[model samples]
Target: MITDPQGTVLALFLIFCRIGGCVMAMPGFSSARIPMQIRLFMAAALSLAILPVLWDTVYPTVHTSSATYIGFIFSELLIGLMYGMLARLYTLGLQFAASIIGMMIGYSQPGAADIFEDAPESSLSGFITFAGMMILFMMDFHHIVFRALVDSYTAMPFGGVMQMRATLISFTDTLSSTTYIMLRLCSPFLIYGLMFNVAIGFINKLAPQMPVYFISAPYLLLGGLFLFYFSVAALVSQFGQSFASVFIGR
Candidate 1:
């Protein structure tokens, strides 16, 4: 049964290279909190699991010369990285929206440690980001990502030349879609902040002697928090719903 143990091992490694590359860049899995050893083992396990299903495609590729094998390794890694980055970029758009929402709503306090990443973020931003990611997990976004990864073998195959132009286009398209979605999510806050500020500006002009900035700060925060409490469910729900279209539709 194990006649070509060397070939099998090579094929497994090739599969590992692709899956490992994906895990390396994937959002939740690639977090700084996750240990490298865990990531490695996870990738290896996935590679072994997928090898049986993809054996026909992968096994033949491994029988090639060393130079060609090296090329395949790079190609596989690039392909997987591209796929992982697609999901990662979409989640990153949520973070961008969080920052925008915080700024628009006057929640500009000093930044605190991010719940998922090592970076610092405002409390409001952190809340939004955390909530969005939680919703994604609840909706089992990883299942979609893994399904895409499995389908990629057929789309990309084992040893095709890496297409740099196509990869760049994919990245740009993901960014474009992500930006539009994030803007849509945060647009309410943008409008609210604008209207509130404009009204304040008129009031300030009328009562120049009053310390309007200091007086309006509390009202701004209160109204913003109240609006957030009422609308957060819809905001995050839309975020979760749009993930499929943004990541898969591309």
Candidate 2:
């Protein structure tokens, strides 16, 4: 049963290259808080689990010359990176939207430690980002990503030449879509901030001696927080619902 052990090891390594590349860039799995050793083990375990399903496709490709094998290694890594970055970029868009929301709503206080990543973010932004990520996890977004990886072998068979143009196009499309979605999620706050500022400006001009800026700060923060509390559930719900369309549609 252990015949061609060398070939099996080679094939497994080939699989590991791609999966490891993905884990290196995937959002939750790639967080700075996660130990490198744990990431390596996860990648290796996934590779072993997937090898049987992809044996026919991967095993044949492992017998090539050393130079070709090296090329395959790079190619597979890039392909996996592309896939992982797709999701990473989308989540990053949520972070960007969170920052915007925090700034708009007068919640631009000092940055706090992010619950998921090591990066510092505003308290409001950190909470929003954590909530969005939690929703994704609850919905099993990782399973969707893994399913996409399995489907990728058919779309991009092993040893195929990497398509640079298509990869760039995919990244571009993901960014564009993410921007639109994030903007939509935060549009209400944008409008609220703009109108509130305009009203405060008028009041300030009318009562220049009263220090309207000081008076309005509390109101701005209060209204923003209230708006956010009422709308946050819907905002995060839409974000979670849109993941499949954005990630899988492309």
Candidates in order have lDDT scores of: 0.90, 0.91
Give the lowest summed-lDDT range of ten residues in model 2.
108-117
**Which candidate number has the best lDDT?**
2
Lowest lDDT 10-residue stretch of candidate 1: 154-163
Show pairs that collide, candidate 2.
none
Tens digit of lDDT per residue, candidate 2, span 18-126? Answer: 8998889988899988899999999999999999999999998787899999999999999889899999999999999998888888886988888778778888888
Error of 2 at 32 (Å): 1.1
lDDT of 1 by residue, 33-119 (tens): 888999999999999898899999899878889999999888888888888899999989998998888888889899899887899
- Candidate no. 1 TM-score: 0.97
Per-prediction TM-score to the true structure, in the order listed: 0.97, 0.97
